[model samples]
Target: MIPGQGGIVTRFAPSPTGRLHLGHAASAIRAHDFAVTRGGRFLLRIEDIDGTRSRPEHVAAILADLAWLGLRWEGPVFQSQRLDLYAEALAKLDAMGLVYRCYCTRAAIAASLSAPHGPEAVYPGICRNRPRHEDTDAPHCWRLDVAKALARTGPLNWWDETAGTIACEAAAQGDVVLARKDAPSSYHLAVTVDDAAQGVTDVVRGIDLFAATHIHRLLQALLAVPTPRYRHHPLLTGPNGERLAKRHGAPTLAALREAGEDGRALADLLRAGRLPTGFSARNA
Candidate 1:
């Protein structure tokens, strides 16, 4: 689906691994506003792909938090319930010779690297040519052969609200894992598939995920999914200029509400680009 073709459709997909923080609030409010302002549909998707870390309490808290902020969504889809859809997408990629089994563990990959690299380091393609086991029970994750996939799709680009038309550089991310050994799908595969299935015309998310859009674009081409317009807004940061995160001790929305903060008021402030004391929006 394309934006402006059949109205705009956006979503706020959050993982249920932790409580919703201010950063998440900023993102949700932006997405909600973008859809509501355009008479479009807003969706809430529970990214509970990591079954081990996802909690039912967190999911409930997310719903309660969004509602408290005066944001209403059409349907709260759960990634856990859409395993079959992800499997079918992966099968299509596998049939195209773009999917391969990767048996490298985190430790193994780290040890194999000659030097330290950025957090989003390119996967060294250690298992790209490994012999595929006929046994389905083998403990291995599926990774996309980025080089081969790019060869099929050739040069590509996507439209972004802020960046205009941007060239895709999927190869920079290397071969991304599509499905984990213990999970049905990875974030790249699941989000790409879900967006198309949900008919999302516009993808509103944080600027931190800007790089991942390259891989998503490539996946869309490989899976033949419709690409949506991207709007990656700025992220909320603390007094130290660091991004708000659970690990950084950012207060959760539940805690803010418990402290007598007005949810609607907070939402309004965020929508107006007026953040609370010691909080700022990081566009870069």
Candidate 2:
């Protein structure tokens, strides 16, 4: 399952919650290049399951930015339009008795944990055994019972471009939410299902998501979908060496374009392992 073999398919799935930033450009470039050089397909997926944050304006901006970068893709699939598909996958998990309703709020979960641990606090599984009532309308999310899922799938491993073969540690994150109360699908569920539907053979993105691949692998096993090879590239950072983030005032691709910076040139530089003056790269 390597790129350039068997008609490699890669994607740059970005959430339309904000403008596309330099960090996103690096990822898009890598994924696009991987497909183009290997004579394969590159896809664009809009991960807009969060209705509260995702905006049409932002999506348009993302398209404009990618076009500016001279990157092309096959299908610009929108997750919001594929709610039924995610629902079908979730129903399969539910039918297997691997999905449960969780009523715990984020603040409540944080309070329940004695001490914050790991990159994210492990979900305490407060509602794992709660009986579901058909008529109940309480706001709750659907979560995957990781222990039960792992029991069915046994041990799992996924290949990473840089890290090589990695064992799955889905339990470390506890029972993760698969569907949100506010949205029909969660990031974990939508991404796994969409990747499978799109026939994505490779996943290229920032290393910040390396930990998430574990949960995704488990989902692929549970849903009986194909698992793709992964390549988690280094994240771009500001001149101060801090990771680029919206909170840190990282400049957006739109801003750079408006400032008369050459988008294609920037893409070329990123492809050559060179970065702009105020940006740097670091392995996450």
lDDT of 2 by residue, 202-238 (tens): 9998898999999999999998999999999899889
Which residue segments of model 1 deviate by more than 4 Å? Answer: 1-6, 133-136
Q: How far is candidate 1 from the true structure (C-alpha RMSD, Å)?
A: 2.6
Minimal lDDT window, size 10, model 1: 1-10
After superposing candidate 2 on the true structure, give the runs of residues whose Cα lies further than 4 Å from its correct spot: 1-6, 117-119, 133-135
Tens-place lDDT per residue, model 1, 14-89, is 9999999999998998888888888888889999989899999999999999988989887799999999999999
**Which candidate has the top score in TM-score?**
1
TM-score of each: 0.95, 0.95
- Cα lDDT for residue 172, model 2? 86
lDDT computed for candidate 1: 0.91
Give the TM-score (vs. native) of candidate 2: 0.95
